[model samples]
Target: MIKLENASYSFKKGFSLSNIDLTIDDGEFVFLIGPTGSGKTTMLRLIYMNILPDSGVVRVGKYSSNSIKKRKIPQLRRSIGMISQDYHLLADRNLFENVALPLHVIGYSKSDMGDLVIEMIEEVGLTGKENHLPDELSGGEQQRACLARALIKDPDIILADEPTGNLDPVTAFDLVKLLEKVNAEGTTVFMASHNYSLIKSRNHRIVEIHGGKLRS
Candidate 1:
């Protein structure tokens, strides 16, 4: 679960978010819609505690941004998976290694890692491409690889920041449908997207942000 109450934060570059109050329940699929520079990414950052609010409170599961210890951030992150607009893959690593990276960091056994990583890659519809590098794949393939990496961790919550931003409409729709399948399997999903027209048909809860504040 994720919750924010009267939260506000400002960056040195002059952007500011004010008085945000939100709650996302477990297993709920929520879409965050807003214009560019509307603080949608900032809101997601607060959930994962990438940046703390200058005022008010942010709670993601049991970790509170107001009082979370620095050492516990890794623990918090392990519970939540993140997919960014920029795939952020290690260009040197092959698809399988990229997806296995998180599992390796968490000390999963080699056997478990092999089985789980392949399962996730297949889920994302990239089975044979496992041995390929990021440069060898198309944009959509890279994003799906990122999704596979995120899902391989078996996170309770998924925080996706503009996951479809770089993909074609058809590819984006396929990605959204994949996310819907993940949500139906009981993982809480909170996605930030500016492409409201593409996702509006999904009929999920939509939270809009503008002027750095939540808008009805």
Candidate 2:
């Protein structure tokens, strides 16, 4: 579970988010929608502990989000999978290496790593591209590789910032459906997207952000 209470953030003397109050239950999927600069990315960043809230409280599972010690940030991040608006893959690494990066960092054995990478690649419907580099694949395929990496960790939560933003409509819909499937299996999902119509059709919980404040 994740909870944000009266949270606010500011940068360069400008407020990006304010007084945001929300609670996400375990195994639930939520769509966060708003225009660009409406604080959608900021909110997702807060959940992943990428940025600390200047005020208020953020609790993810049993961890303190904004107040955790610096060294603990990586550990905290490991517990939550994140996808960015752009596919953030290591250009130098093949799909397998990229997906296994996190598991390797945490010290999974070679055999375990290989198995896990294969499983994740299959999970994301990219079974035959494990050896391809990010540059070798199309944008949508690269995004799937990124998602494979995120889910390979099997984090407690999945926070995505427009995971399907750059994909074609059919690909985007498939990705959203995959996210829902992940939610069904008990991982909490918090997705930020500008595709309001797509989100609305799913009938999930939504919390809008505008001018640095959550909507009423």
Candidate 3:
């Protein structure tokens, strides 16, 4: 449900990601691997609607990302769950509030909200800490909260950039396992990670992005 054709992204004058042609099918778990500054996150930004590409075309769920309407960005983003290395959460809000924020913005009713929020919290294994604020949680807990928030949207595709970058090894492995479970249940996951050793055991389609091009 995500496609890019001859896409390229240029930031200022020194950095450019060129000739990116990628197609991610529904329910497929794909991994994007590379070193620092290799355009991995840049490619994801195109998919997540955070930035427009300098050239070429990108389409997701029948929407042309390069020119999608400003007002529609929220709708488009709701269709895809993005978990970047930096966990984006409202510090003022508690964990439950943060995860339920999306549903609330989308107009989910009180009856529907409780069960959905609780289900997502359970899935992410954060059942009891629902009342804790973002600042009260550790990095891993915050990341889990982010994951719960992402899943609550029930997105068609999940774009995670270094989801486990700073976690301990055990936590990182457990996190990937959680992702695998989500994938098994039909969420298409495109994970960008430099931790190849952790992912090697998963045996999913590994796509390497480096020097602004996709490696075969």
Candidate 4:
């Protein structure tokens, strides 16, 4: 489960997230809708513990923002997949290598890593492009590569922040469908986006945020 209790944070430039509370049960798919700079990314950052909250608590499963140790942060992150608008792929690495990077970080054996990377690539419809570099693939394909990398670890939850912001409408819809398929298989999904039309008809909980405050 993910929960925030009276959580608040502030940036030096004056933007702040006011006292906020939220809870997302396990195996749920939720949508976060807001305009640009409405604290969407900040919320995800807090959940993932990339930045600690200035007050109150943010909890993801067994980890809590108030007491989690620095050494344990990596372990917490390993169970949570993250996708963003930017592909964040290594410039010099091929798709297979890029997707395999996380497995390497966790010290997976060469044979096991190769099998996992290939399977994930195939899942994202990039099977034959394993040798292609990030720049060589289209934007949608790059995004799919990012998705593959995220899912290769079998995360308990996926935090996607405006994942479709860089693609065409058709491609964007396809990505959402892919996410939905992932959710159906029991991975929790919390996606933040400004495009209401893309998600309006979906049968999921929609949480809105504006000026750093949730409006659900």
lDDT of 2: 0.87
In the predicted model 4, the residue pairs found to clash are none
Error of 2 at 194 (Å): 0.6
Query: How well is each residue in 32-74 modelled by candidate 3, as lDDT tens digits?
Result: 9998888899899998778887889888887896679988988
Cα-based lDDT for every prediction: 0.93, 0.87, 0.89, 0.95
Q: Compared with the true structure, what per-residue lDDT tens digits does model 4 show for residues 1-216?
A: 999999999999999998879999988999999999999999999999999999999999999999999999999999999999998999899999999988987889888888889999999999899999999999999999999999999999999999999999999999999999999999999999999999998899999999999996
Model 2: per-residue lDDT, tens digit, 83-155? 8868889999999999999998788999878887898899999999888999999878888888888999898
lDDT score, candidate 4: 0.95
Number of the top candidate by lDDT? 4
| Model 4 misplaced regions, further than 4 Å | none
Candidate 2 segments whose C-alpha is farther than 4 A from its true place: none
TM-score of 4: 0.98
For model 4, what is the error of residue 156's alpha carbon versus the real structure, in angstroms, after optimal superposition? 0.3
> What TM-scores do the predictions have?
0.98, 0.96, 0.95, 0.98
Better of 3 and 4 by lDDT: 4
Ranking by TM-score: 4, 1, 2, 3
